[model samples]
Target: MNHPIGEQTVLITGAGRGLGAAIATAFAREGARVAINYRHSRNHAEALAASIGPQAAVYQADVSDAQAVQELVARVADELGPPTTLVHNALANFRFNGEARKHLDTLQWSDVAAQGEVAVGGLINALRALDEHFTTHQGGRVITVGTNLFHNPVVPYHDYTAAKAALMAMTRTAARELGPRGVTVNMVAGGLLRTTDASAATPEAVFDLIASQTPLGHVTTPEELADAVLFFASPWARAVTGQTLIVDGGLVCD
Candidate 1:
């Protein structure tokens, strides 16, 4: 199957800001029609769509909600045609301050379940919503944003890491099931992104420390990681699926 990035319609959840916004921009730059999905941050998402010109549009939806996701897909199809590529980047609200995080002893199952609802559950919703589109289009691409914490839990963001681990497993399983349909599912994991909304709480010193450990000598930026997402959606990655490409400057190798 030939899935060219330039000819695709890409739907990105939580694209109002941060990494999701960057991913939206990257696809728009590649000539694909972009649907920026946001549960909140309408201003940010709308502003982003404006910046991306007519090729991009904003849609509001809580990806973790099944009905909302169904409506989101229908609205995107009515407004921007069916999205041939899905980027599951929506995350439940979270902060990066390790000091503020609940320790293992204090962490509750609800905390983990909250993250899972958005990470794993959101993916499930997006896939189900796009199933028909993929069937009609003959092929599709699914990219789930993940974290390097799964590989090296240096900071031990227990809930976030656990949810992402489950997402990765689901990604692989979906890839296997979707392969015959010409739909490829994969993951793009990054470490300590230079500065996204979620990482705003992280101290500058931590960035410096992580950079020092990375072979590239710098923490990865959201834009840099977003490029890897384009690669997965591009025809170049037609034969690749069920894989996780870590974009943490060689900090963790899988």
Candidate 2:
């Protein structure tokens, strides 16, 4: 059976593990070559690339740095061909104590702005630098991992939520600007994931509460959210752009 995105190359940030790892694996399963991006988890990223076989490889760079990001994407293009698809899933946190909500004063505004700058800015650079290849190659796809927190602020982590809101806004406007050039942009926002290193600090009670609130009787898994990303990256979703797909197991109806 031929997968929808077969023979394509995908670049995913924060692919050392968790949702990023899931997204990379899903694309690999579809027979797309994958460039797994990581900051400090080089060993784990290499291991995953190996698991995905020869079509997968790892790239290391701190996406927050624009110069480094441009160099990173160029390296991927030289090695595996320009990525036809991109997934931005990297994040940096000041402090995430899931046991208790982070106090406003305790969290710095830069902590939040840094995320938007790194993740969203990095995406812009990748798209712009990779634009020529996409034009030459015909079309490209971009999917950004977002959070449901922006739509419903009930579980307020102001910094994280606010950054995602900004990311979403960027996605919509970028889609409009990039649409004419055969590039599409979209966002897949999920609720608290079931388990990931980033969420390791999350308290068990918080997890239980989220599970109880979801109509599906459980929180979404990283793989589940990855599936939504796959849709946007696949040819089946060629016309779908500037859209936000909420994959929270009905925890958030909006």
Best by TM-score: 1
Runs of candidate 1 with Cα error greater than 4 angstroms are none
Pairs of residues clashing in candidate 1 = none
Note the Cα lDDT for every prediction shown.
Answer: 0.94, 0.83
Q: How close is each model in CA RMSD to the real structure?
A: 0.7, 2.2
Count of backbone clashes, every candidate in sequence? 0, 0
Ten residues in sequence with the least summed lDDT for candidate 1: 1-10
In candidate 2 the C-alpha lDDT for residue 73 amounts to 83
- Expressed as tens digits, the lDDT of each residue in 170-240 for candidate 1 is 99999999999999999999988989999999999999999999999999999999999999999899999
Pairs that collide, model 2? none
Q: Which lDDT tens digits does candidate 2 get at residues 38-88?
A: 989899999999999989989899887777878888999999987788898
TM-score of candidate 1 to 2 decimals: 0.99
Q: What TM-score would candidate 2 get against the native?
A: 0.94
* Off by more than 4 A, model 2: 1-3, 94-96
